[model samples]
Target: MRIHHHIGRRTRSGLLAGLLAATSALAMGIAVAQPGTAEAAASLRSLADAKGRDIGFALDPNRLSESPYKQIADAEFNLVVAENAMKWEVTEPNRNQFSFGQGDAVVNYAVGSNKKVYGHTLVWHNQMPGWTSNLSGSDLLAAMKNHIAGVAGHYKGKVFAWDVVNEAFADGGSGGRRDSILQQRIGNSWIEEAFRAARAADPDAKLCINDYSTDGINAKSTAIYNLVKDFKSRGVPIDCVGFQAHLIIGQVPGDMQANLQRFTDLGVDVRVTELDIRMSTPANSSKLATQAADYKKVMNICLAVARCQGVTVWGITDKYSWIPGTFPGEGAALIWDENYAPKPAYQAVAEALGSGTTPTTPAPTTPVPTTPVPTTPAPTTPAPTTPAPNGSCTVTYVPNSWGNGFTAEIRIRNDGPDPVNAWSFGFYFTAGQQVTNAWNATVSQSGTQVLARNASYNGAVAVGGTVSFGFQGTHTGSNPSPTSFTFNGKVCANG
Candidate 1:
């Protein structure tokens, strides 16, 4: 999910200056609250724990030596995924000859910090050495099985999960399987073989099929959905699905929750793996705000799905984000900024995790009975007919705009005499603006009309209580706000 790159070392002066500023602020009787500090009270790790989810970051072992990086990694996250150490090239670059030095370092760090380790991958086409590509037929098959056994067996009980096969499906079109060396040499059966081998090596660890660009109900995701469905029917030992949510600003998929739900409905856990929202840098306030909303949307999506286990950001800080190198002019992709300071995205993520409802239903140990796939696809938009009026409410809309995009915070208050247990707030966007993503609710747009429903955790509102959610959207020429709103199909007063 990430391209490995070496970051130039930073001098100690930045850390020194940060400490000096904190000290000065403290001496002047000003409060300086830093993430993972007592003054902050809540951390991403602690918040995630309360929600029964793991907050994780991809760790670069090289950066573990730095005090600030180590501190943040230890204090803010409860799960650790190696950025490059566990990949094919790093662990088994020269055929049967293997090395586990760097991988061990990462595992040791995770164990020392009491964080769970999620192995990056066992079978991937891109990171394999040139020798792998040269072999075909039985020779290649043997090598792959051996590699899986060796690597998965080594980490046996140490890792909680393993990405048994990564990025095997191609993007675009019908989302056919990728024509990787493994695919061509061992044929389509290679994927099943790899999973079987991994299970043999580590019976306890959860095995997953990880892929990118499948965060929504697109061609690629549908392909993965069919694969998982097939795997379940044939009992192919897949315990989880990983959606590598490498997204762009104002472009988080609106159907992310629905997509993840469909996977979990198949009786396997789902995870947001290698998540980072990138934007063209030097990050300005507006871009950063939109980025924050995007991050919260992703977190909320994961939280909304009962079987979604956790979310792991690609990296801890923007300084080492792979975006800059892999994507020209796109650098600020992580929650933490380059100076090791928390950005708005960090705060938004923390809040979302903290407010999310803990799932009550446990993941199914045995595969649930499968239902026949409907020949007709489900409608993406809600029903056109409005529901009968149920209650009275009021809505407050606040928007922040930059260029053609904007982020809005909406507050809906219960004005009726009785408390509203579950509600849906609706509005019309008159300016041809379209919502890209939202958080604290499940938001969907059908043309100019948009509907926002309460998430699991925030469904109940007291007689006078209020529920708030935010979204990011785009507009072409005139960005006009919705003049009217509805709550549970009844027209609500504008605030």
Candidate 2:
């Protein structure tokens, strides 16, 4: 959501085949396959247009000033979602007081550009105003309903869709609800109520439940699947299920198509809401190639699903990717590099849509590749050494040095052909450096030695997958980069 800003020198960051045929036939009063991939289409939207689907991207109000961004957005996408502007904290920062300036700006652009607006999310656990956290029972319900009504009502006719409730389930796809203020105060009914309010405000807008880690039929996704089925059975007003296919560079879920198919079978439309494949920093040819394949794999999944409506990448470019800030040592998650030029992933997406060329700009001789720097680093300390008898891991330690404090970015790559259940990193500073702050990891320091243990979210690194994190530290005199790093007591080669 681009909610986190880090400090460095500066701060950081689908109609399916079979049923699509039947549905298109019934809906259009004729049975047929989507026009054989818009071969002549210039932009992604045009390609989707050929197939009678929408191609979209999440837009950031701040990035609109960049001509290339605006140009590409207008050209490639027919649909737009507010990256963060329409969320609770931004829309209703104060009780009953609403600020639609930022969100409206995006809507205004979309309207002017002849694009459809997909309101990002009326309710989310991550970005909410502090005031709502303490409310209970009726107060919470009132606030929730009021916020949804106000935001959804104002954009009543403007938005084509709204994520009425987002990311409500816990990780591990357990079906267990997350411990959120909304859940605590209003319980499970909050979701149905929010959807109802949204419907009352804007009956035509597609109200959806969106979440990550739900691209496949995992525990989390199964939970959402059941919820959608139950909603449909009770006429709960849900129109779509948004699977935020946020994936790693080489790990697109194998059952993605089947998963979306099951959701569509429940009589609700499914969409790929936020798609991006992140890789280890200092992206090499291999990683970027894998990313391109990953993108194509996801695009194909959506293309094959009849009820899959559209596809929206989380953000437009790698420059503003939320990954680096949150994951550390891992980035280059978008199709465009920091310079607004297309990468192989862009071409891959274009090809999948049957629009073989990048839409906005001509191909550059050498596109600037995304690199690991000090933009966003995860912080951490050492943990007890656990031995890995037969695994290989690589580490990349990059320090953005300054006067006394430097932000360190570390990439931990699982080089072996298997996943590491729990990995630990330890390094010793040659200089007198003391760790000050860290995130995305459990970090501790003892004299010149630092140990970083993986947090629950990032501990497991699949074979060839990388996890990154950064930390801020104060160093006396020179801040020498750690000469050696170890993953579970095994020396890690410099990435």
Candidate 3:
């Protein structure tokens, strides 16, 4: 009935005004603003249903409370990712020994609340117990099999997917540390063995090869791509490629869509796993902007590709991110702020995930269904393209596929009783500069909006139906700026 409450408002006056307005509005029957239509519709950016994928966010059960978890549920997120709790040490501390207590808590919570669960890993180089170092040959394999069988078997159908192998390829090459017990004895063949074991444990779930450095056109990514391609070709039981987009302030991977497409073309799904945009230092207003911009571009990639199923932020809140501790000095890299409220990054991500940010003025009075953030096993079937209540409308996107720096298609949809006048669409550039693209939507500098404005062909798109402009901006920075634009209007929101 009211706009959901959260922390992190820049000024006290804004917070008070918001609270006052919410108190007044709560009396009405409005559910938190439904997804979105035309104006600020991030949903429009999403791939249509036939191409759906899972949208997941890693959660810390230890840090979660009933209320906050409920709040997350309200945000419309599709999947719930269990953080360290699903790892070896936390779940199975010693050999045949096991303890799903932590992971179980999360699993139960997800199941109880009707959220899908993604089992983080069956095998990884990190989070294993020290005793594993002593394991050799068949004993190690047995332990791995047992771990997979126990955990995967425990949840079975309830779990949507599993990260079967992690960081198996070294960036510098060298056979990926054959020193680890599984690799040392079983050799590279152990990876297949693990996946086979996972399938044996739970054939109903999706299997993935999760890794970093595979986010772009790097040697490591290509190599892994080949591996997945080969595995799929040979029926090796691999179904997805998880790209851990642990990005930097200005280094959004420009090859995002290409990378996902390459793998998907091989007949396997692709996902952005462990996504985080880290800064070189602690939190500041400027850095937060960088993070938001990073989040926006990342989600845009997921939306552009039909096979790029969905994404999962490694951790939802900056307070619990591994960035501060793992990278030292680099912190505040996720969508949720410290007190568990939507950060600019959260709103941006929500929008990118197809929940449009409603605009003011001509005002978005049309009530649209709040498509939950993500429920991707596959893109959902279309939600019955009903016409807008007041009149016929359409949304179209004339995407600029310079496909060089960023990957997106312009989403042009209108949902209003009357056409909007002197209107333009905008998103924050974060880098303090606008992207330069000769092939994008024609720019209209005549307006005051800073970034870009739509030329004649770009403005006043119809309602319900939409249009898109796609591109690959080649912007790179600590947390890069999007270097692609079609001048729909001056850019307003940013990371």
Candidate 4:
């Protein structure tokens, strides 16, 4: 489900549990529970791993020739994709041929480190052994059956996911060329056969249908969606739809995130498979800058969605890019350069991941308060300016279906044990998902801040009445929870 040149480093950029601070370090035999987390349910949501990134390579065992495999073994990627190493030819060359040397190496490496392994595919048109092209009817089905059973059964529970079907829909339309064996020999039903056979082999692995030219909302993408939709309706056992974003330098498909969300809304997980940014030529400065922007945008979109679980870069470096050898006149589509040094795009990715400190965008700003007007007459004594109350609010914010925004309610309490004038709370959301609605609180979004107005309930909370401040806002890349929630000049613990 992914493509790449050789092994190189594309430095890249997911979620984690609620970021709770440890007031004190662990002092032998002591543990502290994080507050505000929902209690563990009998069957918890899989949102824990709902975000990730990928690693892959071409059809070569010599990927180690580029550098010590340890280089990638130490990276921050969440998953590793064994590109062509698992294909029919490489995995099974002759009759009953089962060569898992290269593929096993990658899998073992990933497993040893507790990372996820997404089986490249059980069926693919290219890289298939030449002998397969001549098979027909029963022979074809038997061949496919053996292929799926052998590979899927071999890995089984060890795999986190499987690319059961790849490139099933073609950009040229008509479900791809009629001559393609998958269509010609067994017809489109082969896809279902492959999935069913794979499930029979390994019921635990999440099965996905991966394809290129379907990363955006296009004809081919639509066709694939309908197929998957119908299959799911009929209990076909499909779990996710993979978007192959083998993008150009600056042309990442639009509506890619929303497209993924729609599929997620259908109750299927979504992933970005075989992601890469190919330039007109390698080492082009302008192209590299654009590639940086492209990488940032890709990470931003994935971070903006809740069900987008994984994103695997086609490969790590541009030096070994599949573009030059595969497409000719195009290459340099990765994060690392020939020297294995990080590229600008790589650094941008690190920043997007929150480990790097390069400021790609401005920081969110807080709204300013208004000052009292002066009296020109100077005759009457100026009335004393009212002071805001020293109250606090409890806001339980839940990120929405899309990672772009969240919803919450802030409950105000008179912490100072004294009645005061009003309560005002303000904070900034980098993307400003916007405040859809609010009550007992006036809200507005500008630049990146959410300004809320809260007057004492019943003109003053009567030394006991309470006011609440709460609203939702869109989230951008690499940001943690909002740190600025205040009521009457005092910051709330969690806002």
Best prediction by TM-score: 1
Residue lDDT tens for model 3, 1-495: 011111110000000012233333233321222121224333222222213455667766755553433444323344677766777777788777788887888788675544568888779866677788777778788888888898899878778889888777776554243255566777878888899999999898999988776788777888887787778778889888888887887789888788788888898888888787777764666676677788889888987878787777765555555665556576667655454444557556656655555311111221111212211122223222322223233323332222222323455444444454334444334332223221113322211122333322224545343433322232333223333222233221211
Q: Mind giving the per-residue lDDT tens digits that candidate 2 earns over 314-384?
A: 77777778888877898888776665545668778878877543222222221111111122223344433
In order, candidate lDDTs are 0.74, 0.72, 0.57, 0.58
Model 3 ranges with Cα > 4 A deviation: 1-51, 173-179, 358-495
* TM-score of each prediction: 0.67, 0.66, 0.62, 0.61
Give the C-alpha lDDT of model 4. 0.58
**Number of colliding residue pairs in model 4:** 6
lDDT of 1 by residue, 361-435 (tens): 101121111111112222335335444345578888877665676657687888878777778988877666777
Give candidate 4 regions above 4 Å deviation.
Answer: 1-61, 65-69, 173-178, 356-495
lDDT tens digits by residue: candidate 4, 1-495: 344333221222111111211221112111222321111110001122222333333223356443322333222344677767777777778757788877888787665443568888788776788888788777988988898888888888777788887776655656553256788879768888988998899989999988877767777777877877888789998898888788887788888887777788777888878778887763556677788889888877877878777567776555466667766677767765543334567656655554332211101121111111121221223223323423444443434323443434454545555665655666654333445444334565554455676422212443444444333333444335554555555655552
The TM-score that candidate 2 achieves is 0.66
Candidate ordering by lDDT (highest first): 1, 2, 4, 3
Clashes of 1: 0
Question: CA lDDT of 205 in candidate 2?
Answer: 93
